[model samples]
Target: MRILMGIFVLAIYGGITFYLGWNLRTWLLAIQQFRWPIAYWIGLYAISFGYFIGKLHPLLTPFSIVGSYWMFFLQYGLILCVIANLLIAFTPLTTKLVGTWVISVLIVLLIVGTYFAYSPVIRNATIEIDKPGEDMRVVVASDFHLGVLSGKGHLEKFVQLSNEKNPDLVLLPGDIVDDSPKRFINKGMGDVMQQLQATYGVYGVPGNHEYYGNEMKQFREAMEKANVQILMDETILVGERFYLTGREDLTNKNRLPLSKLKPEDNALPWFVMNHTPNDLDEPANLGVDFHVSGHTHKGQMWPNHLITERIFELDYGQRGKNDMHALVSSGFGFWGPPTRIGSRSELWVIDIQFAK
Candidate 1:
């Protein structure tokens, strides 16, 4: 049954891609005219091979499985070609077509460069808990994807940024690495973890990407090496003031629970950390004080932020009532293509103050 559903979903995704390609046929043709014939042919063949490899191993690569990354590059190249041809075909007086292309390329480079350079800055915010006379300050970041793209330097920057925050407790909601941490054992992430310093300690939950390759075990081991606490269907007390709970992803129900976890005392301030922001009602009903999460990445690019807003109640900021606030961070790292168009990668600095 699962296989059948997966196949059906893939079929729909493929249809969409094909439709998009068909719509850009004229643009593709025009671009092809400007491209070196051999290079164009080789690029096409490589893209086709990536698609086949992705389909054969969906669990190993979700980006390839959904054809999203490929589609982005393919469509982006086609769009550039189309725009260039339009400019040339129109023969506009100010045609600096080459200049325009150069500018566009530079803009993309600038965006990517800025995202990496400033990615280490930890963003801060404050949240007010409903309880009286008690307060907690929490630091939250998500989607580090710390493998090939992030590497050791990026991890070092992250640790440095996080340390500067001086958070009472740190929350890593998920996607700490792009691949199995074991794959990068000698890459110095362990050393980076050793440098991690938080007053209340660091807690992490698994994201869908971790489950995508069944790499949760490797991820947990990596976190442990860094002295991070992995919270899977469990709750803990911090400073005799708040209850911290972490849950497994919604899709992995067999490995964890889908329902809300109850605290031993109903009056204590409680914080719940989960990957996706779905199932708010469960926590709300349980009187969870705040829910911190970051799977949306605010679409990680332009126009897609709108899509994320529609899909999630709290897509990239604070929402819900004073009793139960749901805060979602845009994320600290990029997922694919290494670009963030409309949304900047962010970290949440939440100050939880109990009312007096």
Candidate 2:
């Protein structure tokens, strides 16, 4: 079934690539009398499919970086092409004119989207809980995707942002690294992350990407050396104030359920770090006080958020279910290309007030 699904997805991707390439070919032919079909097709496919090809090995980091950018280009370009074709068909608009408009629009989007991608914004929220404790400020960031495309610089920015907030605790819900933590480790990003300042400590859960890398031991070692704690199906008490349970990413089939992970004798408010927001009902059903997650990237690109919205009830931002408050970050890093359209790279600063 998985094989079939993969093949089906690839087929659709290939079809789209062909459609886009053909349309662009037509535009080039008419506009500039561009005639290098061989070179054009090779360049187009390389950019379009580079991400997947690069993912086959860690050495092809350059290809992955270039290919990732194609994701947004493909999405927006395809949309523009479809619209342009429709206008040309229905109206008296010529292909050359529509082509010019579409290309110009894409250039503008590229510039604006790149700005949003690189500029990480802070989003603040306040939550009141019935548990007794001091009001705490928690800085939560996720999906650092700290690989070749997103390196030490982005991590430094995240550290600076979180430290500036003077958080009581720093929590990384997941995807702290890209598919692999190789670049993060080699570039000494862990040393940079060690600079994150918080009253309690820094902690993180594994995102599916971590599992994809299949290098948990190394990833854990790097994080620990940098003073960031990795929580598998583990629970810890923060200065006797609250309980934090880090659930293994859904990628782990054998990970414990919330019922087993949560301490039965606990009275303090419990905060759960879940990488993906799919199993939200479990946390709510288990009476978790707060649940935080990432991995959605809120569709990182435009209109993609629409798809993510359909997949998860609370795909982005804060929502409440029963007594549990859930917050999902769009993530602080990009997945493929460092380009975000509808979503901006964000760090969430949550102010939690407890009952006296």
Candidate 3:
């Protein structure tokens, strides 16, 4: 069934590309006065092919595993080139297609240089909890996508950044591993897990991608080796003042049982962690004090942010209802294309101070 779905998607993608190419030719011919350079056509073709390879390589096994990181870099290069080409094409100045292609290639180089040289340090924010005397600092990062697109180095960087914050607790909402940890055994997902540090400890829940690849067990093991806890339909009491609850992906299971939590048990603040922000309406009834999540990487780029905002009520910031505070991180990694045109990768620092 999955195979059939994959084939159907590929077919649709191919059809769309063919249609675009055909129409593009017609548009070029209509504006015949400007001699479109051969270089422009060649560059466009290369960019398109690079993107296609990046998209499809992960479906092929050993090849997918080895090519994942390479594919990310390649796609990043192609996108910058494509953007530069578009810029030159739209410029008021008239130039040969060759000049446009050269400019586009340079743009790609500039993008690569700028990104590697100055990838921004992760940003941190603090949230105050309703606990008294004791305060808990929670470091939150989501969408780490730790497979082919992002690797051990990126994961290490994330850990280093999180450690710098010296968080008491670390929360990974979901999409920590892109596909499967087994795909890159030598890459040592387990080793990366062991490096994570926190005092109260780290907690994670499965995201959509983990379910898609059927890698939840491996993912859990990796986290466990790192001493990180996987919280599924469970709750842990913190410092005798607050409860941290984690639920499985909301979309996977509807109508979770809240009977286990008594209304009289609200002695401390309650924080709920889930992958997607779907059940905000229900948690309020359950008397949750706060909710934390990340699935929308703030669109990871432009225009898409607009769409995500429209679809989700609490897309990338803080919101509240009935005493429940909800925060959605923009995420810590990229999905497709490996480039973040608008949103930067994020690391959330929540400060919970107890009330006297």
Instruction: Find the candidate with the highest TM-score and give its number.
Output: 2
TM-score leaderboard ranking? 2, 1, 3
| Candidates 2 and 3, the one with greater lDDT | 2
What is the TM-score of each predicted model, taking all chains together? 0.79, 0.96, 0.75
TM for candidate 1 is 0.79
lDDT of 2 by residue, 1-356 (tens): 99999999989998999998898888887798777788888888887889878887778767787888788778898999999999999999898999999999999999988899889999999999987888999999989999886788888889988888999999999999886777888899988999999999999999999999999999999899999999999998888878899989989999888888887645798999999999788889888999999999999988888899999989999988999999999999988778898999999999999998
What are the RMSDs of all candidates, in order? Answer: 4.8, 1.6, 5.9
- Candidate 2 has its poorest 10 consecutive residues by lDDT at 258-267
The collision pairs in model 3 are: 37-97, 127-350, 127-351, 129-352, 131-354, 131-355, 132-354, 132-355
| Off by more than 4 A, model 1 | 1-39, 47-72, 78-121, 132-134, 255-260
Q: Which pairs of residues have clashing backbones in candidate 2?
A: none
Sort order, lDDT high to low: 2, 1, 3
What does candidate 3's lDDT look like per residue over 212-252, in tens digits? 76777877877787677888777888656567787777556
Badly placed stretches (over 4 Å) of model 3 are 1-12, 19-120, 131-133, 183-185, 254-264
